[model samples]
Target: ETVDGPPGARTYRRTLRLPYGIGIAAVDERPGTATGGRGARPGGWLDARLHLTDPRDLTTAVQRLRRLFDLDADPYAVDARLGADLRLAPLVAARPGLRSPGTADPEELAVRALVGRDRAALLVQRYGKALDAPCGTLTHLFPEPAVLAGAEPGGTLGALTAALADGTLRLDPGADRDAATAALRALPGLDDHTVAVIRTRALGDPDVAPPGTGAPDDWRPWRSYALRHLDVAGEPQPRLARAGR
Candidate 1:
């Protein structure tokens, strides 16, 4: 969505998955000079502002944004540990600080995991709430679990939404990782692969091993990044990029 303004001042805007309440984040895409341009590589810049419904949501909002950008990770420590491994050393050398991308909304991600991209998009278009003011092509806040529960209440999507809406299964960052994984696995129709995706993306557990892939011991607490590095055959994607978001 583009916020209305003067030329060269257009801002891409969207509703966020805030803790206390729904919020809007407007991000300016224009590049800017860094603190030290000399010896600095070229990169894109974003000037972002968040408008929240409540003042108390600030802390959670900031944390979510950090997770969204994978900013809180200590890349030096992660690289030091993983770069020593024979399998990942060269990849780590090639890409100094790889990070695992996290999600802003866990429940939404869980639903998308089951329904696939096109169906998820259709679900958003069908049930999402329209913004008070539209922003270019972005106009809806992806439907919350409760909303989706009412929209679909019998199939796998319904079961997942019901679990999410009632808090029977918690996928938040603060949720207990092992317990949440178990609970998600116990849910009807949710397989190990789906649970693993939730653990990696939703819960932000960087060390989560894939369903059957064996990870080295040194990759602990950062195996998710290592898995991502392996997924690309040593060429990892940028940290800020979301996978098909």
Candidate 2:
């Protein structure tokens, strides 16, 4: 849920499902000014605040927030490496410190990835857990894997949910990236692109270059950020140019 704020700032507030209970997460974002040239700041910064029902969950909440915002990334290093690439050089220069987003809830992201937003909304309406108090339009927590698993959504979604519910697939922040990728690959009906999406966004693997995009090998460990640069620049292909071209 979002609320209009003074001038350029926007405030978004929502209820976050925590291990103990629910917490309110709020963010106030303001777009940065363009100063022009190579060093220009292209994006905005946000201020986040969390109201937790159980203070004991503060550490977990903070960690989740960090992942959600990609705060753990070293943008300067990433920029230096990606900016050296002729194909991504201009984009890196334009949007320095740009981050590849990570999910607040891995299971939720996985479900959304498979079902798309519309079907996920329907699932939310039907199975989402109601908050004791709604935060703006955010009245329910995203349905848990156990709940959705029991709902018996058929086909790929059902299989994915069941795996998540029973721990056949682990998407938690601490889960092993390679193992999870293999597990996702083993599931029928999950294409390479979908698995890559889950690995990059849900598991927070920064190096995955989506299947068959022919991403350069040098983009290792930052391929996800490279892909984000292309996405922001609206380039369908990497189209890397020779170094001196």
In terms of lDDT, which candidate is strongest? 2
Q: 185 in model 1: Cα distance from truth in Å? A: 0.7
Estimated TM-score per prediction? Answer: 0.79, 0.87
lDDT of each: 0.77, 0.84
TM-score of 2: 0.87
Cα lDDT tens digits, model 2, 1-245, are 34657766678675678988788888777577667568655555577788887998788877777787788999999999999998899999898998998877889999888889899889989999888877678788889988998896668888899999999999998899999989998888999888998999899988888766778988876999999999988988555455684
Q: How far is candidate 2 from the true structure (C-alpha RMSD, Å)?
A: 5.1
Candidate 1 local lDDT, 209-230, one digit each (tens): 7666666667787888888888
Per-residue lDDT, model 2, residue 83, is 92
